[model samples]
Structures are given as structure tokens and as C-alpha cells.
Target: MFMLKQQKAKIIDEVTKSLSNAQLILLTDYKGMNVENITKLRDDLRKVDAEYKVMKNTLLKISLTNVGLSIDDLSGSLEGTTAILYTDKDPVMALKVLYNFIEENGNIPVVKSGFFERKFIDQAQAKEFSALPPKEVLLAQLVGQIQAPIYSLHAVLSGMLRKLVYVLDGIKDKKPN
Candidate 1:
């Protein structure tokens, strides 16, 4: 019992450190998952540079308090078997990745709540948001959209210049003839 308590304390400290630097923290319930499934989930998360771990809800609450975070809403989410995910990268992308994995796997736990960009997202909102495209793809699409006008202007100007050059050549040839 003492060893388990110490271990829980260490896990809380580790989670606290992760939360300190992480831009997002997601809590989920993994009650039905087995070791193999959990390992697979962890590996998938690692590919995208996120960390997943299990910890006692009480210790997690202590960590949140220690960090001066307001976790009142998170209290309800603390019930039931839980796992936490943290990432220093864009929190949205992390949520997106995990939620997508859950969607595909079809047998894991469900997301309960998320802390992202200083806002709390409920399970439904988290699922909806995570289904969207990743950050890079969204940024690339935005850049392309922003540059469309410039690209079109350049094309139009080039076409006009080509026509002008063709007219000038025609005039020159006729004059010499």
C-alpha cells in the first residue's frame, strides 16, 4: 500500500511537470482497454509527440491545484477509470489525433473533457473538433487561399504582356514588308 501510494505520488508529479509545459491536457476513460490495446494507443500517440499516462484522480487534482489551475469543472470528469494525455504542441492537433484514433479503434474509452487554449471542451465538442484536419494541412490551405489573388494577378499580367508582344511583332513585320 505504501509503495502504491509513493508510485501514485510520482505519477502525479510527472503529470504535473507535463502539464506545466503542455499546451493541452486531455482526460479520458479507459476502463475497458487491455494492456496490448493501451500499448498500441500509447505508440500511436508517441508518433505524434504526445504523452499518455494513468494516474489517481486525487493526485491529479492536487497537481492541478498546485499549478493554480481552476479545475472545478474537471471534478465531474474525475469519476470512472481515466487516462490523461499531454502535448507541448498544438493542443487541438493532439485532441484531433486521439479522438480520431478512438473513432477508428472503436473499442477504447471515450474522451470526458479537455483543457485547451485556456478553455474547457466537453466530450461532444472535443470529438467534433478532433475530426477536423490537422494544423499543417489547415495552415497550408489558409496560405493557398491567401495567395490566390496574387497568383491570379500574376497570371493575368503575364497573359496581357504576351498579347502585347504578339501585337508589337505583328506591327513590326508588316512595316518592314
Candidate 2:
């Protein structure tokens, strides 16, 4: 009994550490998902530097408390076969993988709720998050936006220079040789 308690405490500590480091935390109902599917999901998450873990609700609650999060905020999310998807890196990538996996697997696991950027998000919000383009794409778009004016300015300056050169050549040609 004492050993069991010690193990549980260790597990709680590990979970607490994970919770603290995670930038995005999603609670999912992974009921009815087979071992193979769960393994595949874990591999997919791993590729994005995220993790998928099936943890006991009690231990999870304890970990949440340790991380200074109120369980009440999560309310009803801890029930059932809860699996946690957490990532310290790009949250949107992780969410995309999970959503894509769900689509391919007949929606075996459903997202119950999520905690991202220090706020709670529902299923619809999670889907919205997944719909966002990847970080690289967003960054590229921003760079293009920032450079658009510069490109336009260059074009205008070059056009004026070309016109001036043409007028100078015309004047030179008209002058008596």
C-alpha cells in the first residue's frame, strides 16, 4: 500500500511537470479507440513535439491543482476515458494532426475541451484552431505583407528613372550632331 502511494505521488509529480511546460492542453475522450489507433496517434503527436497520454482523472486533477489551475474551469472534462494532448511547440500543428487522425479514424476520439493561451476552449474552438494554417505559412504571409509596400516603392522609382533616361536620349537625338 505504501509503495502504491509512492508511485502515485511520483506519477502526479511527472504529470505536474508536463502540465507546467505545456503551451496547449487538450482533453479528449479516447473511448473506443483501439491500441493500434492510439499508438498511431501518439506517433503523430510525437512528430509535432506533442504528447498524447491516457491518465487517470484523479491524478490529472491533482496535477492540475499542482499547476495552479482550478479543476472547476475544466468541469466535466475529466470524466470518461480522458486523454491529454499537450505540446510546448506549435499548438496548431498538434491540433491539426489530432483532427486529421479523427477524420481518418471515423472520429473515434472526440475533443472535449482545451486550455490554450491561458484560456478554456470548447470543441468548436478546437476545430477552429486546427483550421488555422501552419506557423511557417502564417510567417510567410506576414513577410509578404511587410514587403509589399517596399516592392511597390521600388517599382515606382524604377519606372520614373526609365522615363527620365528615355527623355534624355530623345533630347540628345534631337540636338544637332
TM-scores, one per candidate: 0.78, 0.87
Tell me the TM-score of model 1. Answer: 0.78
- Candidate 2's TM-score: 0.87
Q: State how far residue 57 of model 2 sits from its true place (Å).
A: 2.0
lDDT of each: 0.80, 0.91
How would you encode candidate 1's per-residue C-alpha lDDT over 1-177 as one tens digit per residue? 245877877877777777887777788899878888788888878877898888677887888777667889898888878788888887766776787678777847678886775477788877777777878899999999999999999999999999999999999989956
Model 2 agreement with the true structure over 24-49: per-residue lDDT tens digits: 89999999999999999999999999
Please tell me which predicted candidate would have the highest TM-score against the true structure.
2
Candidate 1 ranges with C-alpha deviation above 4 Å: 1-9, 90-93, 104-107, 162-177
How far residue 24's Cα lies from its native spot in candidate 2, in Å, is 1.6
